[model samples]
Target: MADEIKPAAQQQVQIPVDVSNRETVYANFVQAHLNADEVYLELGQFSQVVTPTGPDPIVLSHRVIMNFVTAKRLADLLRRAVSQHEQMFGVVEVDPNRRLRVQQPPV
Candidate 1:
Protein backbone atom coordinates (compact mmCIF):
# COMPACT_ATOMS: atom_id res chain seq x y z
CA MET A 1 0.00 0.00 0.00
CA ALA A 2 1.25 3.53 -0.84
CA ASP A 3 1.82 5.87 2.07
CA GLU A 4 -0.35 8.97 2.26
CA ILE A 5 1.22 12.42 2.56
CA LYS A 6 -0.19 15.11 4.81
CA PRO A 7 -0.78 18.68 3.58
CA ALA A 8 1.86 21.31 4.47
CA ALA A 9 -0.44 23.16 6.84
CA GLN A 10 -1.55 19.93 8.53
CA GLN A 11 2.02 18.61 8.79
CA GLN A 12 3.57 21.72 10.32
CA VAL A 13 2.39 24.37 12.74
CA GLN A 14 3.86 27.80 13.52
CA ILE A 15 3.14 29.21 16.94
CA PRO A 16 3.38 32.93 17.61
CA VAL A 17 5.00 33.73 20.98
CA ASP A 18 5.27 37.09 22.72
CA VAL A 19 7.68 37.61 25.62
CA SER A 20 7.87 41.35 26.00
CA ASN A 21 7.34 41.35 29.76
CA ARG A 22 8.61 37.89 30.62
CA GLU A 23 10.63 37.56 33.82
CA THR A 24 13.85 35.60 34.10
CA VAL A 25 14.98 33.94 37.31
CA TYR A 26 18.13 32.14 38.33
CA ALA A 27 17.91 29.23 40.76
CA ASN A 28 20.74 27.31 42.35
CA PHE A 29 18.52 24.85 44.15
CA VAL A 30 15.32 23.08 43.17
CA GLN A 31 12.92 20.81 45.03
CA ALA A 32 10.17 18.80 43.37
CA HIS A 33 6.76 17.95 44.73
CA LEU A 34 4.47 15.67 42.74
CA ASN A 35 0.77 15.04 43.19
CA ALA A 36 -1.84 13.17 41.18
CA ASP A 37 -2.45 16.03 38.78
CA GLU A 38 0.45 18.47 38.92
CA VAL A 39 4.09 18.94 39.84
CA TYR A 40 5.45 21.75 42.00
CA LEU A 41 9.00 22.94 41.51
CA GLU A 42 10.44 25.04 44.30
CA LEU A 43 13.31 27.03 42.89
CA GLY A 44 15.72 28.73 45.26
CA GLN A 45 19.23 29.91 46.02
CA PHE A 46 21.38 27.72 48.28
CA SER A 47 24.09 29.04 50.53
CA GLN A 48 26.33 27.09 52.89
CA VAL A 49 26.71 28.48 56.39
CA VAL A 50 29.35 27.17 58.71
CA THR A 51 27.97 26.51 62.18
CA PRO A 52 29.41 24.80 65.24
CA THR A 53 26.57 22.28 65.18
CA GLY A 54 25.61 20.25 62.05
CA PRO A 55 24.92 20.42 58.32
CA ASP A 56 23.75 23.64 56.69
CA PRO A 57 20.06 24.16 55.98
CA ILE A 58 18.65 24.91 52.52
CA VAL A 59 16.24 27.79 52.18
CA LEU A 60 13.74 28.02 49.35
CA SER A 61 13.03 31.37 47.75
CA HIS A 62 10.80 30.77 44.72
CA ARG A 63 8.41 28.22 43.28
CA VAL A 64 6.87 27.24 39.96
CA ILE A 65 3.89 24.96 39.50
CA MET A 66 3.42 22.93 36.33
CA ASN A 67 1.27 20.06 35.23
CA PHE A 68 2.58 16.47 35.09
CA VAL A 69 2.71 16.47 31.31
CA THR A 70 4.62 19.74 31.22
CA ALA A 71 7.01 18.52 33.89
CA LYS A 72 7.70 15.36 31.87
CA ARG A 73 8.35 17.39 28.72
CA LEU A 74 10.66 19.74 30.62
CA ALA A 75 12.56 16.78 32.05
CA ASP A 76 13.03 15.25 28.62
CA LEU A 77 14.11 18.57 27.10
CA LEU A 78 16.58 19.26 29.92
CA ARG A 79 18.02 15.75 29.62
CA ARG A 80 18.64 16.19 25.93
CA ALA A 81 20.14 19.68 26.37
CA VAL A 82 22.42 18.48 29.16
CA SER A 83 23.56 15.51 27.08
CA GLN A 84 24.39 17.75 24.16
CA HIS A 85 26.20 20.22 26.43
CA GLU A 86 28.29 17.43 27.97
CA GLN A 87 29.23 16.20 24.54
CA MET A 88 30.37 19.64 23.45
CA PHE A 89 31.95 20.82 26.72
CA GLY A 90 32.24 18.42 29.67
CA VAL A 91 30.05 16.59 32.15
CA VAL A 92 28.39 18.69 34.81
CA GLU A 93 29.17 17.28 38.26
CA VAL A 94 26.76 17.93 41.10
CA ASP A 95 28.97 16.80 43.96
CA PRO A 96 31.27 19.57 45.21
CA ASN A 97 34.28 17.34 45.85
CA ARG A 98 33.86 15.43 42.60
CA ARG A 99 33.39 18.66 40.69
CA LEU A 100 36.66 20.07 42.02
CA ARG A 101 38.49 16.95 40.88
CA VAL A 102 36.90 17.02 37.48
CA GLN A 103 37.84 20.67 36.98
CA GLN A 104 41.52 20.11 37.84
CA PRO A 105 44.07 20.08 35.06
CA PRO A 106 45.60 16.70 34.21
CA VAL A 107 49.28 16.17 34.90
Candidate 2:
Protein backbone atom coordinates (compact mmCIF):
# COMPACT_ATOMS: atom_id res chain seq x y z
CA MET A 1 0.00 0.00 0.00
CA ALA A 2 1.26 3.44 -0.91
CA ASP A 3 1.67 6.08 1.83
CA GLU A 4 -0.41 8.44 -0.28
CA ILE A 5 -3.52 6.44 0.51
CA LYS A 6 -4.79 6.42 4.06
CA PRO A 7 -7.29 4.00 5.56
CA ALA A 8 -10.87 5.17 5.31
CA ALA A 9 -11.25 4.55 9.02
CA GLN A 10 -8.47 7.06 9.73
CA GLN A 11 -10.18 10.20 10.89
CA GLN A 12 -8.67 13.61 10.73
CA VAL A 13 -9.24 15.10 14.14
CA GLN A 14 -9.96 18.78 14.58
CA ILE A 15 -9.25 20.65 17.78
CA PRO A 16 -11.29 23.75 18.53
CA VAL A 17 -11.41 25.94 21.60
CA ASP A 18 -13.95 28.50 22.81
CA VAL A 19 -12.20 30.91 25.16
CA SER A 20 -14.80 32.58 27.31
CA ASN A 21 -14.93 34.69 30.48
CA ARG A 22 -16.51 31.85 32.42
CA GLU A 23 -13.30 31.92 34.44
CA THR A 24 -12.81 28.33 33.33
CA VAL A 25 -10.83 27.05 30.36
CA TYR A 26 -11.02 23.83 28.32
CA ALA A 27 -9.38 22.87 25.03
CA ASN A 28 -9.49 20.15 22.33
CA PHE A 29 -7.58 19.62 19.11
CA VAL A 30 -8.42 18.03 15.75
CA GLN A 31 -5.79 16.53 13.48
CA ALA A 32 -6.50 17.48 9.86
CA HIS A 33 -3.39 16.15 8.19
CA LEU A 34 -0.28 14.01 8.85
CA ASN A 35 2.94 13.97 6.88
CA ALA A 36 6.72 14.02 7.11
CA ASP A 37 7.15 17.71 6.37
CA GLU A 38 6.58 20.59 8.74
CA VAL A 39 3.51 20.35 10.99
CA TYR A 40 0.64 22.84 10.84
CA LEU A 41 -1.96 24.11 13.33
CA GLU A 42 -5.13 26.20 13.32
CA LEU A 43 -5.61 28.04 16.58
CA GLY A 44 -8.93 29.75 17.18
CA GLN A 45 -8.76 33.45 17.73
CA PHE A 46 -10.51 35.06 20.68
CA SER A 47 -11.82 38.61 20.78
CA GLN A 48 -11.62 39.25 24.51
CA VAL A 49 -12.01 37.65 27.89
CA VAL A 50 -12.32 39.90 30.92
CA THR A 51 -13.40 38.48 34.28
CA PRO A 52 -13.00 41.04 37.00
CA THR A 53 -12.25 40.09 40.58
CA GLY A 54 -12.69 41.94 43.84
CA PRO A 55 -10.54 44.74 45.25
CA ASP A 56 -7.15 43.75 43.81
CA PRO A 57 -6.37 42.49 40.32
CA ILE A 58 -3.38 40.27 39.43
CA VAL A 59 -3.87 37.59 36.77
CA LEU A 60 -4.24 38.72 33.17
CA SER A 61 -4.44 37.06 29.72
CA HIS A 62 -3.62 38.81 26.49
CA ARG A 63 -4.51 36.87 23.33
CA VAL A 64 -3.45 37.95 19.89
CA ILE A 65 -5.61 36.83 16.98
CA MET A 66 -3.33 34.78 14.76
CA ASN A 67 -4.55 34.99 11.18
CA PHE A 68 -2.05 32.34 10.23
CA VAL A 69 -2.84 28.65 9.85
CA THR A 70 -1.08 25.36 10.64
CA ALA A 71 -1.17 21.84 9.32
CA LYS A 72 -3.18 19.12 11.06
CA ARG A 73 -0.19 17.38 12.57
CA LEU A 74 1.26 20.55 14.07
CA ALA A 75 -2.09 21.36 15.60
CA ASP A 76 -2.22 17.93 17.17
CA LEU A 77 1.25 18.37 18.66
CA LEU A 78 0.30 21.67 20.16
CA ARG A 79 -2.79 20.15 21.67
CA ARG A 80 -0.72 17.37 23.25
CA ALA A 81 1.82 19.85 24.57
CA VAL A 82 -0.94 21.76 26.31
CA SER A 83 -2.32 18.55 27.77
CA GLN A 84 1.04 17.46 29.13
CA HIS A 85 1.51 20.84 30.68
CA GLU A 86 -1.81 20.70 32.49
CA GLN A 87 -1.03 17.19 33.69
CA MET A 88 2.41 18.07 35.02
CA PHE A 89 1.12 21.03 36.98
CA GLY A 90 -2.62 21.51 37.20
CA VAL A 91 -5.56 22.91 35.31
CA VAL A 92 -5.60 26.68 35.21
CA GLU A 93 -8.43 27.79 37.42
CA VAL A 94 -10.10 31.14 37.01
CA ASP A 95 -10.97 32.87 40.26
CA PRO A 96 -14.18 34.84 40.11
CA ASN A 97 -13.22 36.83 43.21
CA ARG A 98 -9.47 36.59 42.99
CA ARG A 99 -7.04 39.47 42.72
CA LEU A 100 -6.57 39.09 38.96
CA ARG A 101 -8.47 39.04 35.65
CA VAL A 102 -8.29 38.38 31.92
CA GLN A 103 -8.44 41.30 29.48
CA GLN A 104 -8.11 41.66 25.74
CA PRO A 105 -8.96 44.20 23.08
CA PRO A 106 -12.22 43.85 21.25
CA VAL A 107 -11.82 41.86 18.06
Highest TM-score against the true fold, candidate: 1
Cα error, residue 68 of model 2, in Å, equals: 11
Best by lDDT: 1
- For all predicted structures, in order, the TM-scores are 0.73, 0.25
lDDT (tens digit, per residue) of candidate 2 on 1-107: 65696567967899988767446433232223334654433323343345574333323242222223444455588789988998998665546455255555689
Off by over 4 Å in 1: 1-11, 49-59, 102-107
Scored against the true structure, residue 27 in model 2 reaches a CA lDDT of 26
Which pairs of residues have clashing backbones in candidate 1?
Answer: none
> Candidate 1's residue-wise lDDT over 40-70, tens digit each?
9998776667678965777787788999888
lDDT of each: 0.84, 0.49
